[model samples]
Target: MNSSMFNKSNATSSIGENIYHYLRKGIIELKLKPGDSLSAKNIAEQLEVSRSPVRDSIIKLGKEGLVDIVAQSGTTVSKIDLDRVAEEQFIRFSLEEKVMMLFIEKSSSREISKLEELMEMQKANLEKKEYNTFLNYDDEFHSVFFETANKQMSWELIVSMSGHYRRLRLITLWDLEIAEDVMKQHYDLLKFIKEKNIDMARKTVQEHTMRIFAQKDFMVKKYPTFFKEKNDEIDLFNNFKR
Candidate 1:
């Protein structure tokens, strides 16, 4: 795995904090991948850091549900938890739908054109086959809605809770068909916004953001081990929640 992403400096954070950030980014961005092994010794050697900070970061990541550390065994990146994904997606859909509707109601054509520019930039990255940059633009496009709607706090909350969902989205976006479909939906979202059609905007958000649930079967079947499977315990807990 290319562990070089951590090299980008954050001067204030401690060595352990930096390791935690690097490992978390790798896990979330699919560089390390679900179920990929991580050794503190190897990581320390690779990073030219001591094992103490490396181990500390792994423990911190484990607490955040991004990694699993087993005594006498090893640490591995955690698989995507669909239950958490579903819950977080619902949270995202609720907030983002309202954000989009608000943006449409209040935004000028000039603001809408700015969104178009972002889409064009995303498209350029896709054409260049740089999916990571494409995903970054995708984030900027959506963030503009929250920023414009004055819901930056809600955006931060959604991001804080969306580690699993983001990982799955990264995996999903790698498919050309799916990526193109997502881009088209983005365009349709802009159309609804330009028309100031709240109903259609709601529909688009529901369809576009919630499409992941529909694709769950495809995702699980293709990458079985990367997703957490449902089981009796899970069903029992869900039933209990009701």
Candidate 2:
């Protein structure tokens, strides 16, 4: 792993939070591979901080299911749990569909214009092969509906629960075709929303949100070490019930 990736010049945040963000970003970007060992002491030495902050960050990451801490053993980046990803996908799709319904009812032309601007940005990023930046624009496009509908807190909650899904998405960014397809989906969804076609918008959102599942087999085969074996008989709804 490149320790320099963790190095940052900002000093506004607490050391623990800074370490947490660094490790989280590395994990999401696949710099810290699944099952890779994480040495708190070594990271502390590299960051020129005491182990306390690193340990705190590790514990926080553990709570997020991003890392596993074994007693008398060492910490390792957690394998991508497909079950968690599916659960999060479901939650996000359901909530966002509801938010889109509300947005369609109340959205003004100005808000629609904002989404169009984001779509243009996504197109530009795609043309430049800036997949990461394109993903950021994609996120912002969806977020506009939530922000306009006064659901920013709900958006935050969904994002907090979407770590695994987001990491999986980051891996998929290498597929330029998928990026292009997603941009088209964004455009179609935006069109539906602008037309006040709530049903079409909801369907579009559902299809777009669940489309990643189609690549499950390919992703697992390509990155075998990053995924854990999930029981075929497991009931996703039951397992993820609150």
Candidate 3:
């Protein structure tokens, strides 16, 4: 291919990636709040790309439950479903607890060293007040454990549920004291896992997931507009009390 054609192809690929990552990050961070309207044309214009790539990105986001396309109205950010989130949390907890147990059994001292390094990074991020960076390292710490255990699907499940917990984490990041407590729990968990204590690791994983789910009320009240209207189906969130 000619140099001009190669450059054009490269630019198109770059635009596609930019559009995808822009929307994905917004959804993951809850910046594109639930039920927020989305427009391919507007997104394309804003990103300086063609509508086709924008449309493709929207479709991809939909599969991830980050966006919704109404038949007649338009595309919109997805409303938070408390029940679904709970279900995902349950599944993730069950899977990851097992993975954590396996990790405790199989991990080496070198792997523990890697985890400690990640924890140190998280601590540094916390000191710097870089909440997002802390999150990245926190994820890395957990992911390394799962990867060491060869639990790819479990890791994927954890990664998937991250978006569900992202908004809550964003809220929690504001409280330095609470963040410190969380960091301490992570440290304890790491120590127990490194000691090859399966029971402690499982309990720690369960406790962590439950703690996250306990924030449901705070999220729902703080962002009432982020939920969908109740249909004929039962609304468990309706009975949720802080």
lDDT of each: 0.82, 0.84, 0.74
Give the candidates in order of TM-score, highest first. 2, 1, 3
* Candidate 1, poorest ten consecutive residues by summed lDDT: 232-241
TM-score, cand. 1: 0.86
Clashes of each: 0, 0, 0
Tens digits of lDDT, candidate 1, 51-146: 998898998888777887888888899898877777778789889977887888778877888899999999999888788788889888998888
Global fold similarity of model 3 (TM-score): 0.82
Model 1 bad stretches (over 4 Å): 1-12, 232-242
Q: How far is candidate 3 from the true structure (C-alpha RMSD, Å)?
A: 4.6
Q: How close is every model to the real structure, measured as TM-score?
A: 0.86, 0.89, 0.82
Error of 3 at 227 (Å): 3.7
The true-versus-predicted C-alpha distance at residue 53 of model 3, in Å, is 1.8
The whole-model C-alpha lDDT of candidate 1 against the native structure comes to: 0.82
Per-residue lDDT tens digits for candidate 2, residues 1-242, read 34444445555666677788888878876889899999998989988778988999999999999999999998999999988888788889889989998899989999989998999998998899877677778888889989999999999998778888887887776788877788878888988987889999999998798778777667888988998778851366344433
Q: How close to the true structure is residue 10 of candidate 1, measured as C-alpha lDDT? A: 38
Q: Estimate the Cα RMSD of every predicted model relative to the unseen true structure.
A: 3.5, 3.3, 4.6
Look at candidate 2 and give me any clashing residue pairs.
Answer: none
Q: What does candidate 1 score in Cα RMSD to the true structure?
A: 3.5
